[model samples]
Target: MSTRTAELLASIALIVFSLGLMWTVHTDGLKIGWVPERGPGSGVWPFWLSLGMALTSLWTLVRWFRRTTPESRNEAPYIESDRFGLVAISFIALTAMIFLVAIVGTYISIALFLGFYMRFVGKHSWPMTSATVLGAVISIYFLFEWQLSKYLPKGLPMFEDGFLWLDNFRWEYFM
Candidate 1:
C-alpha cells in the first residue's frame, strides 16, 4: 500500500481503538476522577490517555484529509522492497522472543532477543552486546524482583527451579 493510504488507515484505526479503550474504562466502573482519599482513581490515567489518543488521531485524520502532513501527501510504498527483509527479520525475531518467553522464561528470552538483535541486526561488538544483555537482565531483575517484590514468569519447572536458586543465592549473599 501507498504511504498516504497507510497513514489514513492507521489514523482511523487509532481513533477506533482509543474510543474502544475509553468505553471499556468507563464500563469497568473505575472512577475517572479523584477519589476521597486517593489522589486519582484507577481509570483516570487510562481514560485521559485514551482521550488524548483519540484527539490526536482525529487531528491526524483532519491533516490527512487536507494532505497537510508529508505522509498524507506521499504516494510511495509503505515498505520499500529492499527494506522489507529487515522488517520481516525484526518481526520474526520479536515473535520468536515472545514464544520463547513461555518456554525459557522472561529473563532468558529477553537476553536471547537482546543478544540476537544487538549482535546480528545492530552488528555491535561481542563485548558490547554481552554487556548490554547482562545490564538489561540485571536491571530488570533488580527493579521488578528485588525492589518491587514482583516475580515474573519463570517458564517451565526447570527454569523455575533455576530462578528459585538464584533468588536464594541473592537473599543469602546480598540481603
Candidate 2:
C-alpha cells in the first residue's frame, strides 16, 4: 500500500526465501570436505546470509510497528510515481538476465544484459554502448577465462563438450 508497507513486505519475502534456500542447501550436503580441510559447506554462505536477512526483516518490522503516527502513516510514496516504470523495467531486466543464465552461457548473457541496459535503459549512444560492452567482454574473457582459469557454468553437458571440442583444435598446423 505505502512505501513502508511495501518495503516491509519485500523484506519479509526475502527473509522467507533466504531461509528456504538455506534449508535446501543444508539438506543437499553443505560440506564437500570431511576432516582435514574444514572448508565452508555449500550452505555456509546462504545460512549466514539468511540469518542476516531474518534479523534485518525483524528489525524493520519492529521499527515500522513502533513508528505508527497519524502523519507518519500517511507519508509520501516509497518511490516516485514517475520513476516506477523505469525501476520496474530495470528489475525485470535483471530477473530476465538471471533466468537466461541457464539458457545461454554467462559470457553471452552478460554481454546481452550489458547491451540492453546501456543502450536501451541507460540511453547511451550506440558507440558508447558498443565500446563498453566489448571492453567488458574482453576484460571478463581475460580475467576468468585466462587469468583465473575458472570455468563458468556452460548450461548443459552437450554445450560443454562442444566447447571442449573447439578448444582442442590445434592452431599450429594452420599457422
Q: Which stretches of candidate 1 lie over 4 Å from their true place?
A: 7-73
Give the TM-score (vs. native) of candidate 1. 0.60
lDDT of 1 by residue, 1-175 (tens): 8999999999999999999999999999989998998789999999999999999999999999999999999999999979998999999999999999999999999999999999999999999999999999999999999999998998999999999999999999999
**Residue 135, candidate 2: how far off, in angstroms?**
1.3
**Would you give me the overall lDDT of model 2?**
0.74
True-vs-predicted CA distance for residue 130, candidate 2, Å? 1.8
- Highest lDDT: give the candidate number: 1
**Predicted candidate 2 versus true structure: per-residue lDDT over 1-175, tens digit per residue:** 5776676677678778867876777788775334356666566677777778778777766666777533236457877789898999899988988887787767677888999999999999999999999999889866886577777766567656765654455233322
